[model samples]
Target: MASDLVELDRRAVLTTMATAELVTLDDLSRPTPCAGWTVGDLLAHMAAQHRGFAASARGDGADLAHWHVRPPCPHTPAEYAESADDVLTAFAVPDVLERTFALPEFGPEVTVRGEQAVGFHLVDYVVHGWDLARALGVDYALDPDAADPVLRIAEMVPDGPDRDAPNSPFARALPVDDGSAPLDRILRLLGRSPTWPDRPDR
Candidate 1:
């Protein structure tokens, strides 16, 4: 499961990078599914997350400085790509899955096993990759095998008031039909709409 999670995470991050590369300067101003954040803002957040996860993989995640989001700039895509590389490299270390990951963003004393942390990262990129693709009016896909595990993790995320907290990355969960597609179900569980900018009231 650990190895599978790593491969899926790698694919998700790489897919996100490919989608980001398709963005021209003018596309940066485009609105994203993430409320109030533009494409550029999404890229900045993604890059910061990459750096933070890399630091956590290296047992250096407790420092809040590593997770600070960079301001959007013309070279945001390239910066995001670099951060992606850093994270992939960090996760490549021997016995990394056996180490503890300090995720200070969760709380000052929060820590989790490496495999769990990787699973968390995997779910994040899977969703955020879709966010970027939707923002760019493109498509994003993860490995077919990823749907089950990702969905399980998404289900485990609390659907309560914490979602509305300041700077929370997710919003309140939305209801989905029992027959909804796997990806759509996962998205709704994480407070995202698969249809995105095309809501009926919009």
Candidate 2:
């Protein structure tokens, strides 16, 4: 089951990377419903995140300060996409999951089981992929196998200090009715107000 989830996440990451690559630079500068970040900022964030994940997979501890963006270049979109693909490939390497990961923000260099670390990467990218799509007027969907685990993880991210920190990008928790579907609830739980603001009023 764990192996299957990892594969599903790997596939989702690849698909999301493709979608991100197709996004135009014009779209990157537009306002995303995500509030603070423009399209470019979001892409930059994802690129840095991919590099950070790659570093961890290579046994480099997640030193937040080590997170640096690739130097600005003319073909920024292509560069970001390539970086994302590189990280995905790194994560897919044999026995990567079995290795220890040092996430400094999470605390002193704790060894993360390979499977769990991949799961974390899966959830992060899938959600961010949706963010990219939402901001760019593109469609984004996650593999059910991948989305299921991410939804579970999203549920576990309490609407507390982690979600409400001073510089947190996530919004305050909104009241969701019991019957809301997992995906919708998950989006709302993570700060996206599920109602599509782009729709015109009849």
Candidate 3:
């Protein structure tokens, strides 16, 4: 089961990479769904996160330095691809699911089971993949197996003042109709508007 979950994470990551490949240097300044972050900023953060998760897989995640996001620089897309490959390789280690991941960005002593951590990683890519696609004015879709589990995980994310705090990674959850599609519900639960620019065609 853990391996299956990791496979899903792999698919999500690969999908995100595919979307990112469409980005060009000219697109770097474009704003994304992540509020103030432009495409370049988002890619830099994504690559840093990949490296951090890879370090976590290797029992070195306790170092906060591993999770730091740096300024956007030249050849960011290439760097992002390399970071994605690094993380995927690290995650393929034997017994990886049995390891503990230290996610200091959550808190100083924050730790999660490898399986749970991978789930976190999976959801991050799913949403960020959507973010990238939207910024590029393109469409994005997750693997069929991902919708249910990612939605389940999104539902489990607590909503409240914590989300309103400064530098909060997520925004406050928005309302969505009960009959909304899985991806719509998932986006709202994670504080993203499906019609991000208020377009009727979204």
For lDDT, the strongest prediction is 3
lDDT at 76, model 3: 72
lDDT of 3 by residue, 1-202 (tens): 5668889999999998988899999999998877787888888888888999999999999998888886546537888899999999998887778899999988989999999999889888999999899999999876789988998998998999998876455778888677988888888998888998655322
Model 2 lDDT at residue 26:
71
- Per-candidate TM vs. native? 0.95, 0.84, 0.94
Residue-level lDDT of model 1, residues 1-202, one tens digit each, is 7778788888888888889889888988999888878888888888888999999998899998899886545547889899999999998887778889989988999999988998998998989999999999897776688999998899899899998886567878889776988898888988888888888311
Spell out the clash pairs found in candidate 1: none
- What lDDT score belongs to each candidate, Candidate 1 first? 0.86, 0.69, 0.87
Which scores greater on lDDT, model 1 or model 2? 1
Query: How well is each residue in 1-202 modelled by candidate 2, as lDDT tens digits?
Result: 5767567767867776777777776776776655666777767767776777778888785676545555555335776777777787877777887887766656666667777777777777777777877776778765766656777777766686676564354666666655876666667767776664655211
Off by over 4 Å in 2: 70-75, 108-111, 166-169, 199-202
Q: lDDT of candidate 1?
A: 0.86
Note each model's CA RMSD in angstroms: 1.7, 3.2, 2.0
Candidate 3 clashing pairs?
A: none
